[model samples]
Target: ADLQEATVLTATAEFLDDHTVRVSDNSGQETLIADRIFINTGATPIWPNIDGLLASKHVYSSTDLLVKDKQLKELVILGSGPIGLEFASMYAQFGSHVTIIDKSSKILGHSEPEIAEQAKNDLEEDGVSFLLESNLTGVNDTLNGVTLTI
Candidate 1:
């Protein structure tokens, strides 16, 4: 808990040289010597050539829906890629009504057809809904709490 608190403190640094630094915070300023700085912000998600889709609430990047809120009984999910489907499975198992939309006619495209079919059936048995071969025109239906128009 102490480390977590320390990690949240904001500090300003003035570099004296490659190995020397100055730090300022609420307590005041100080100079110190350091060997290196490491940055590990992780991967970036890139979407190429899709217009106006970013503004649609229906278009949730892999990150947004990761934290499942059980109180939300209905979920309209976009995409059937690993990331999207993984969340779908997790949420459905937790008892949310999950609807997944995939542009391709067959989901899990790279997998064998039978494997994909079986997996789809399994998820269906678990009460997950899918709208395959559907192009997301927008998100406008309020009837189901959420819906992706094709």
Candidate 2:
């Protein structure tokens, strides 16, 4: 919102000793006379702590890769929860060559076993590879494109 719409109205002022009145600004940033002050910066996505994970250019966040790419030859999804599977399904439908990896033994680990199996079957039938009980050890750039070492 425009600060021009705001007025310097006094909130519940607290006077410490005789000299100072604490102030509040409704719109956000605050200031004090001395050099000491605290400023807050809000949220940013936390990248996984995998080694060399941040250095690669082809490495894209779930937001960028999922929403932007209509089609791709292959995908290596790192998680197998609902969110990761959802992305896998959407991208696979969009004709991405997809692969999903997780440390758990089953794809839908929390779901009913039979249902999860059926879902896994459907996904595999549609060409999504499930790498279960696996760990992503490293990532390497290959001649053709990118290779994810799991």
Candidate 3:
């Protein structure tokens, strides 16, 4: 295979020059300088610039939720994009009360209306709630859980 001759590294990379890069993992025990590099732009969670969101200890990114061991009783998601809807469906199946709040009036805005409606109905049948055309103004960490000001 083409990758048989490749020296692959799973680490953070810093471009030192046009053809050179320095790569190291969190341990900092091993570092490598490579003249040739192939970039794989993987998905990363983005924290929106919403008030009290970054400061709240009760909030977790999608990445954090993926590795989380504790089961949640209730969940609130901020988007209706593919990734968000996928999470909503998954969490709802897990018996978590899932709510998705989006600024848009409809889910799957780019897809056909019929298909979108069916998807929404399917999610709703599985006990997922949608708050359309709503903006989350802030997040507050409560004694019980998190509260969103919409």
Instruction: Give TM-scores for every candidate, taking all chains together and pairing residue i with residue i.
Output: 0.57, 0.62, 0.69
**Residue-wise C-alpha lDDT for candidate 1, range 1-150, written one tens digit per residue:** 112221433588777888887789999987777675322232334453444566545455556565534345777666666566666776777777998888899777877788678778877987899999887665543544444456
Best by lDDT: 3
Model 1 clashing residue pairs (backbone): none
* Backbone clashes in model 3: 0
| Candidates 2 and 3 compared by lDDT, better number | 3
lDDT of the structure predicted as candidate 2 = 0.68
lDDT of all predictions: 0.66, 0.68, 0.81
* Model 3 alpha-carbon miss at residue 114, Å: 2.1
| Segments of candidate 1 deviating more than 4 angstroms | 1-53, 56-59, 68-70, 140-147
TM-score, model 2 to reference: 0.62
Candidate 3 structure quality by residue, lDDT tens digits, 1-150: 112233657788777776667677876734455554334343667788999999999888888888879878999998877678878977888778999999999997877788678779989998999999999999998998788899
Root-mean-square deviation of every model: 12.5, 15.6, 11.7
Candidate 2 clashes between residue pairs 3 or more apart in a chain or in different chains: none
Q: Model 2, 1-150: lDDT tens per residue?
A: 112331344444444434444666575433334332222122334467776677766677766773673457778888776667767876777677888888899976777798678778878887899889998877766678677777
